[model samples]
Structures are given as structure tokens and as C-alpha cells.
Target chain A: MNLMSAISVALLALRVNLLRSVLAMLGIIIGVSAVIAMVSVTEGAKRAMEERIASFGANLLVIRPGSSAFGGRRGGAGTATFLTDADVEAIRSEIPGIVAVSGEMSGSQPMVVAGENWTTNVQGVHSDYFEARDWFVESGRAFTPAEVRSGARVIMIGQTVATELFGAAGPLGQTVRVGAVPMEVIGIMAPKGQSSWGSDQDDTVFAPITTARSRLFGYQFGVRDPVFTIYAEVAPGTNVSHAVADIEELLRVRRNIQPGAEDDFSVNNLAEFIRARNETETQLGVLLAAAAVISLLVGGIGIMNIMLVSVTERTREIGLRLAVGARRADVRNQFLIESVVLCVTGGIAGMAIGVAGAYGIGNLGDFPVSIHPAIAGIAIGAAVFVGLFFGFYPAHRASRLDPIEALRFE
Target chain B: MAAPLIECRDLTRVYRMGGGEVRALDGVSLTIDEGEYVAIMGASGSGKSTFMNLLGALDRPTSGSLKVAGEAIETMGPDQLAAFRNRTIGFVFQQFNLLARTSAEDNAALPLIYSGLKGAERRERARARLQQVGLGERMDHHPSQLSGGQQQRVAIARALVNNPRILLADEPTGALDSQTTVEVLGIFDRLNAEGITVILVTHEQDVADHARRQIVFRDGRIVEDRR
Candidate 1:
């Protein structure tokens, strides 16, 4: 039979039992929608991670003290202060591609401002700390060189700390007591929102590293001017790996680590972490796609099951058509076309539902979700494939039925 | 003389039942000329239905030389037989096997689907046939909406819509009342008078008497042939 007649016949059959056709298509709809929604979510997460990497400075690197073993007791990372001021100075003077470098020490302290007390994170660093972290002062000036030389009790506060301690009033030039030292707030850093690690980024204060070492926390035994971590920025167009190698070599030489001995610090590439996160998202996307495909396969099985039942139910109809001179292929084509129509229709509905679901989820969760055209195409194609794959068996069986027996099937 | 429209030489059909074989048609032979109204009368299991099946090209004889419209039917492939049936024969059944929920016109146009006729032409031909069967006003009515006699008329219209030369009916009026039976037989008589060959299978003598020639079957063999 020609395509038009086959399609018409199939449509007639489906229309005769609309409820059964819809029920058979339900599996395909759910499968396709799930695939689309899952893919969108993964893609959205990947995009968000990329944006985070861009915002956190792609050329940034962090150097932290390595774990130290003493008397057969192993200390965790950053437990030993092997890095010193000389190592930071050597990295600045010796490293060729270094753009900015800052030594950073961080601790939590309760601050009193205008008779309001709030516990907040406090970071001590040089003037270049803002540049290395890609942060800028929103309202007031940054600390001057005199502040670093004199170990001045001046500070920069973040938006959250400002809101908590000062409320609606301007925090610049306000006096806040950090632990036992009274400091003047020099600047309020721009809002940085949340970190990728889910920590509040704008809930901190900053001071010169010299002031923090001498005033806030007393020096430990056998350590002087100690800092926890060092932040470095590579120049634009310079390879971060090359810069990292230079810093490692310079630090090793300055710290006097023996040849063939482990270095006293660990150099970490920030972009590498982002790339790993992307890899994880990609793996999750693949896993979700596989699950969706399995669901589609299940839906295809549902189509096959219903088609087989339809063939059995229409045995007498087949016999009648055969007696009226319909070729066996005609009957097969009719049923196969019917299944494809059902699946394609379901695929369209599924695409709409999936896109709406993704939009809803993205808005509700405050994330980005992108629906790729290729994914939609794949979904529809898979639905069609499922239809053909599952429809063939029942159609073949219907085609091979004996007209005499079928007519007598009652 | 022109060759008969249908001719069978020593036709035989056997069915396998649990390692045993039962002969449904035991070397039966017959010839049906064009434009003849012939009735086949037999009790159940007398092979009358089997004979109708063979004549309609719905099944092949196990061993025989069967020809319809001067073509060897037993040698034809399944597709070729189907095409031959489309072009040369029409069938009416006792159950009036009209497709449910389909309009009478569409049901009548079913055979033309294999003919590859365009939709408008198929419907046009179907409309003409339905009018010929006196169901012109009910062309859009589904089988469920039509009475038994009207449904049978629709089936007859569907059979004739292909413009086949031969009509093979198996107990065509078996489900109708006597009055409706006469009406259906009248249709058969009128179509036969129009120079179309009609072969009907029935056990009722009254139905058989409507035909000009009668053949009776007993034990898968023809016992009497009379005109």
C-alpha cells in the first residue's frame, strides 16, 4: 500500500482506541522528558562552574604549607609553617611571569563596633591581596604602604560584616575593635556573593599581615611572621603551569630544602580544580543520559506489548483486509506507521514538558539551564527508533497470519 | 468456446491434526463458467467453505490445478494471488464483516487501496457501488448504525466496489430474517442478471433455490449437481 493510505488506516485505528494509544505513549513521554531535564541540569551546572572559574580568576594559584611529620606523628596540610617572608620575597623578585603575590593568614575573631558584637572571619594580607583575589574596594580607599610598614591597626570589612556590625550606616572610617586592638575600617569590599564551596564570601574582614601577626594571634614557638597560605596571580597570556614551576623552584631554593627532598609547600592550580569539576559534571550527564535511554527502551517495550495485543485483537480485521486483497506488507505497514505516529507525537509532548520542567527547576534553584537543539533531535530520533524497533515483531506476526484461520478466529 | 472463468482439476486439501491428516477436499473437481449464478449446498464439514476459500484465492489446494480468470491460481505467489483476487473476485460473508467505526464508503473503498487508486477516485467508485447496492443515502453511516440487511448491503457494495467479475459469497444471508434473506437474494439475482458470475455457499435449500444451478457436497465430495 502507498504511504497515505497506510497512514490513514493507522490513524483510524488509533482514533478508534484513543485511550489505549495515549497509555502506550505515556512511557515514551516520561522517558524523553527525563532525558531532556537531566541533560539540561548537567549542562547548567557545567556552565555555572565555568562562570565560577572565570570569576575566581583563571590565572590564580594558591601555595600552602605541606604536611610535616614529627616524631612519627604526621600533621595535616598547613599544620607546619615552612613558608616564610623570604620565600614570598624570592617569589616576587625571582619569578618571571608573576603579576601579584600576597601572604595570607586567616582566623575568626569577635569584633565590637558601635556596641554591637559579631563573630566574623578575619584575613591578614598585603595591599596586593585584593588584586590577587580580583576584589576591589566598593566605597573607601585601600590601605597605604605606611600601614604595612607601621603594622597599623587599619582594616577592610566585607559587605556581610558591614551589614551585621554597622547596619544601614556607612562603615568606612568607623572604629571596630578586633580582639583587643581597636582598628579603623578603611574600606568595604564589593559583594562577592558565595564561594563555590558554599561558604559566605562576604562575611570577613581584612587587615595587614604584620598587624595580625603582632596583635591578633601571638606568635607560636620557633616561628616568626608566619602565614597560612600564599596567593599568586600569573600575568595575562602567561601559562599558569610555567609560573607555578618558577614559584616552586624559587621557593625551594629560598627555603633551603635539600635536593631530592619533598618541598615544604604545595602549589595548586585553580583552573585544574574547575576542569575536574567539569569532568565530574560530564560524567553525571552521561550517566543520566544512559538512564534516560533505558527508560526510553522500557517505553519502547510498552509500545511493542500494546502493538502485539492490538494485532491479536484485530485478527479478524486482518483476515477481512486480506480477503479484500490487501497484501501482507500493507497490513504490516499500517501497524508500523501507527506505532511511529504514536511515538513521534509523544516525543513532541515530552519535549515541551521537559523544557518547561527545566525552566521551572532553573528558576526555582537559581541556576542556569540550557536546552540544546541536538539533544532534542536525539530525543525525537530515539523515540522513532524505539517505535520501529518495538513495532516490527507484532507487525511481522500480523503479516504472517493465515487468512483462513484469522477469519475463523471469531 | 471460451475457457471457463474458474476451473479446478482434482483439487485436494488436507489438514494435519496431532500426527494424523484429515482430508477436507478429497480430489474434488469442478468448472464454473462466466455469468452463472451457482449455489453450493452442503452440511457443516462438507468442504463447501473450503471450496469457497479456494475459489476466492484465499487458500491454495494441496494438490490440484486450479485456475481463475484463465490464470493458474495454485502456482501464483501470495502477492500475485492477492492482486488477482483484487482484480477478478469479490467476497461477501455471513457476518457482513464491515469494519467497525468506519463509514460505509470507506469500508467499500478498502479493496481499491491495493489498486493504488487515488483517494478521490476510490471514494467516487465506492459511492457509485454503494448507490448500486441501494445504500447511497447511508454512505457515511457506520456498520453499527445500519440494520442487518443494510449492513449486508454495505458488504455487498464493498465487494462489488472493486468491479470484480466474480462474486464468491459464503452464507451471505445466513444471519438475516427470511424477509431480509429475500431482499439480499434479490440483490444477488440482480447482480447476476447484470452479467456478473455469482457463486454462493449455503445449507438452506431455500437459499440455494435462488440460484439457477445447484451443487451439493457430502463427505468433502460433490454428491449431486443439478440445474
Candidate 2:
């Protein structure tokens, strides 16, 4: 039979029982929609991670004290007090790719401003900390070298602290009590929003390292000018891997570690963190893809079952067609085409549902969802494949039926 | 003299049932010329239906030479036989097997599907055949909307849409009442008068009387042939 008539007859057959046809298609629809929604969600997560990595500064590195082992008990990472101010100075002078270095010390304290009290984290660093972190003062200037050296009672407040301490008022030149010490606000730092870890970056105050050590957090005995973490920036056009290697070598040599012994510090590159996050997203994508595939497989099996039932129910119809000069191939094609049309229809509806579902999830959960056209195309192709792959057996059986026997069947 | 349209020489059809063979058509030989209205009369298990099946090319003879429309059908492959049947013969069943809910024109045009005819041409030919069967005014009506005789007329139109030289009816009026049976028999007589060969299979003597010739079967063999 010609292609047109074959399609028409198939459509007529499907329309004879519209409810059954739709029920048979439901599996495909759900499978395709799940795939689309899952892929879209993962794609959005990947995009969000990339943006966070970009915001965190590609050329930055964080140095922290390594885990310490004492008397068969191991402390967690960043528990040792091995980082000191001298190491920051040595790196600034000795490393080739070093652009800026800062020694950081942080602690939480209650501060009162205009009789409105709020407990916030206070971070202490040198003048170069702003440059290394790509932070800028929106209104006032940063602390000078003299202020950092003399442990001046001056500080910079982040946007969140500024708003809380003095709403709609100038925060500069205001006095805020930090624990028991009163300090003047020197500048208002620009907004940094939230970190990828969902911490509020703006809910902090910045002070000179010397002031924090002497007046707030007491120094560790026998460890001169100790700090918790050190932040650094690499010069542009410098390979970060080589820079990281150089920093690692410098710290290892200065810490007097034996050859083959574990180092007392850890050097972390932002790029490494970005790569790790991307790997995690890839793993998540794979898991979602597996789920989608399983759903599709189930849907394909449903199609096969329905097609078999249809073939058995229409044995007389098959007989009639065969007797009317319809080639066996024609009968097979008609049934196969019917299945494909059903799946294609389901695929289209599933796509619509998936996109809408993705949007709904994004809006409700405050995450992004990106529906890639390539993924959509693949989903539809997979649905069609499912139809053909599952429809073949029933169609083959129908084609091989004996006309005489089939006509004799009730 | 020209060859007969159908020539069967000692045709035999055997059915295998549980390690035994039952001969459905036992050494039956028959000849039918063009433009002859013939009735095949037999009781159940007399092999008249098997003869009709062989004539329609719906089955192969176990051993014998059976030729239809000057072609040896026993040697034709399944596909070739299907094409041959599509082009050379038409069938009307006792059930008046019109597809349900399909328009009369489309039902009549069913056989044309195998001919690879375009939709417009098939529908036009189907319309003309329906007019010939006195169903032109109800061409768009579905089979469910028509009477039993009207549905039979539609089936006849479908059988004739391919313009086959021979029309094969296997108890065409078996499902119809007496009045509708007469109406359908009148259509067969009219087509026969128009020089198209018509074959009818029935046990009713009145049905057989409508044909110009009659053949009776008993024990898989023809017992009588009368004109």
C-alpha cells in the first residue's frame, strides 16, 4: 500500500479507541518529561557553579593550616596554628607570580552602634587584603600602612553591618564598640552578596591584623604574629599551577619539613575548587540521566504490551486486509507507523510538561533551569526509538499471520 | 477457442490434523469461462469453500494445477498471488464485511489501496462503482447508518472498484433478510447481465436459480453440473 493510505488507516485504527491510545502513550510522555526536567536542572546547576567560580576570582588562592596529629589523635583540617605573618612576607618577597599577600585572622564579637547591638564576625587583615580579594571601598579610603602597623582602632564595615548599625545614615566616622574596644568606621566596603556555600559575605567587619592580635585575639605563645588563613593573588598571564607549585615549595621549605614528611599547611586554588564542583555536577547529571532512562524503558515496555494486545484484538482486521491484497509488509508498516505516531505525540506533550516543570522548580526553589535545544531533540529522538524498538515484535507477528487461519479466528 | 478464465485439473487440498491428513478437496477438476454466472452448491464439509478459496488465490493447492485468468496460481509466490488477486478478482463475503464507521466511498475504495492509485483517482472510481450499486446518494454515509442490503451493496461496490473481470461472492446474502437477499441478488443479476463473470456459493436452491449455471459438490468432488 502507498504511504498515505497506510498512515490514514493507522490513524483510523488508533482513533477507534482513543483512550487506549492515550494510555499507551502516557509512559513515553512521563519518561521524556523526566529526562528534560532533570537535564535542565543539572544544566542550570552547572551554569550557577560556573558563575560562582567566576565571582570568587579565578587567580586567587587560599592557604590554611593543615590537620595536626597529636598523641594518636588527629585534628580536622585547618586546626593547626602553623600559618604566621612571616610566611606571608616570605611569599610576597620570594615568589615570582605573587601579586598581593595578606595575613587573615577572624573572630566573632558583639558590637553596639547607636545602642543597636548585633553579633558579627570581625576579620583582620593588612592593606593589601582588599586588592587580593578584589574588594573596593565605596565611600571612604582603606587603612594606611601606619594604621596597620600601630594597631589603629579603626575598621571597615561590610554592607550588611553598615545597614544594621546605622540605616540610611553615613557609617564613616561612626564609633562602634567591638567587644570592649571602641573603633571608628573608616570605610564602607562594597557589597559581595553571598558565597557559593550560602554564607552571608556582607555580614562581617574588617580591621587591621595588628589591632585584632593585640587588642581582641591574644597571640599564640612562641608563635609570633600568628594568623588563621592567608589569601594571595597571582599576577595576570602567570600559570596558576606553576604559581601553586612555587607557593607549596616555599611553604614546605620555610616550615622546615623533612623530605617525604607531610607538609604543615595546605594551599588551595580557586580553579581547583571550580573543577571539583564541576565534577560533582557531572556525577549528578549522570544519576539523573540514569533515572530518566529507566523511566523511558518502562514506557517502552508499556508500548510493546499495548501493541501486542492490539494485534491480537484486530486479527480479523488483519485477515481482511491481507485478503484484500495488502502485502504483509504493508500491514506491518501500518502498525509500526501507528506506534511511532503515538510516541511522537507523547514526546511533544512531554516536552511541554518538562519545560513547565523545570520552570516551576526553578521558581519555587530559587535555582536556575536551562532547557537546551539539543537535549530536547535527543529526548524526542529517544521516544521515537522506543516506539520502533518496542513496536517491532507485535508488528512482525501480525505480518506473519496466515490469512486463512486469521479469517477463521473469532 | 479461447482458453477458459479458470482451469482446475484434479485439484487436491489436504489438511493435516494430529498426524493424519484429511483431504478437503479430493481430485476436483473444474473449468469456468469468462462472463459465466455460476453457482457452487454444497452442504458443509463438501469442499465448496475450499474450491472458492483456491479460485480466489487465498490458498495453495496441495497437489494439482489451478490456473486463474490464464496464470498458473499454484506456482505464484504469496506476494505475486496477492497482486494477481488484487488485479483480477473481487470478493464479497457472507458477513458483508464493511469496515465499521468508515464512509461508503472509503469502504468501496479499500481494494484500490493495493493498486497504488492516488487518493483522488481511487475515490473517483469508488464513487462511480457506488453509483453503479445504487449507493451514490449515500456515498459519505457510514456502514452503521445504512441498512443490511445497503451495506451489501457497498461491499459489492468495493469488490467492483478494481474493475475485476470476475466477482466472487461466498454466500453474500447469508446475513440478510428475505427482502434484502432479493435486493442483493438483483444487483448480482444486473452485474452479470453487464457481462462481468459472477460466482455465487450457497446451499439455497432459490439463490442458485439466479445463476445461469449450477455445480454441486459432494465428498470433495463435483457430483452435478447443469446449465
Instruction: Provide the TM-score, chain A, model 2.
Output: 0.71
Give the DockQ-based CAPRI class for model 1.
medium
Candidate 1 local lDDT, A1-410, one digit each (tens) = 78977887788888888999899999899888888888898888888887777667768888877642222324554455556665677777888888888888889999998789999988989777788889988989888767976899999999999999999998888899999899999899999888887899999999998898889877573566677778888888998888888888887776777999777677887778777767866786788788788889888998999999999999999998888888889888888898888888888888888888888878986757988888779778878888888999999999999888988887
- Which candidate achieves the best DockQ against the true structure? 1
Which candidate tops lDDT?
Answer: 2
Off by over 4 Å in 1: A57-255, A275-294, A363-367
Estimate candidate 2's RMSD in Å.
5.6
Assess each prediction's global lDDT (C-alpha) against the native.
0.87, 0.88
Instruction: Give me the runs in candidate 2 sitting further than 4 Å from their true place.
Output: A2-4, A58-61, A66-193, A200-250, A269-291, A359-368
Q: How far out, in Å, is residue B91 in model 2? A: 1.2
Interface RMSD of each: 0.9, 1.0
Q: Taking the tens digit of each residue's C-alpha lDDT, what string does model 2 give over A1-410?
A: 77777778877888898999899989888889888888898899888777776667658888877742222324555455568899999989999988999999999989998779889999999888988888888888799879999999999999999989899999899899998899999999988888878899899999999999888887453588987888999988999889889998999888877899776777888767776867766686788788788988998998899999999988887877788888888889888887787788788888999899888878987767888889769777988899899999999999999887777677
Model 2 lDDT tens row, B53-113: 9999999999999999999999998888889888888889887777887999999999898
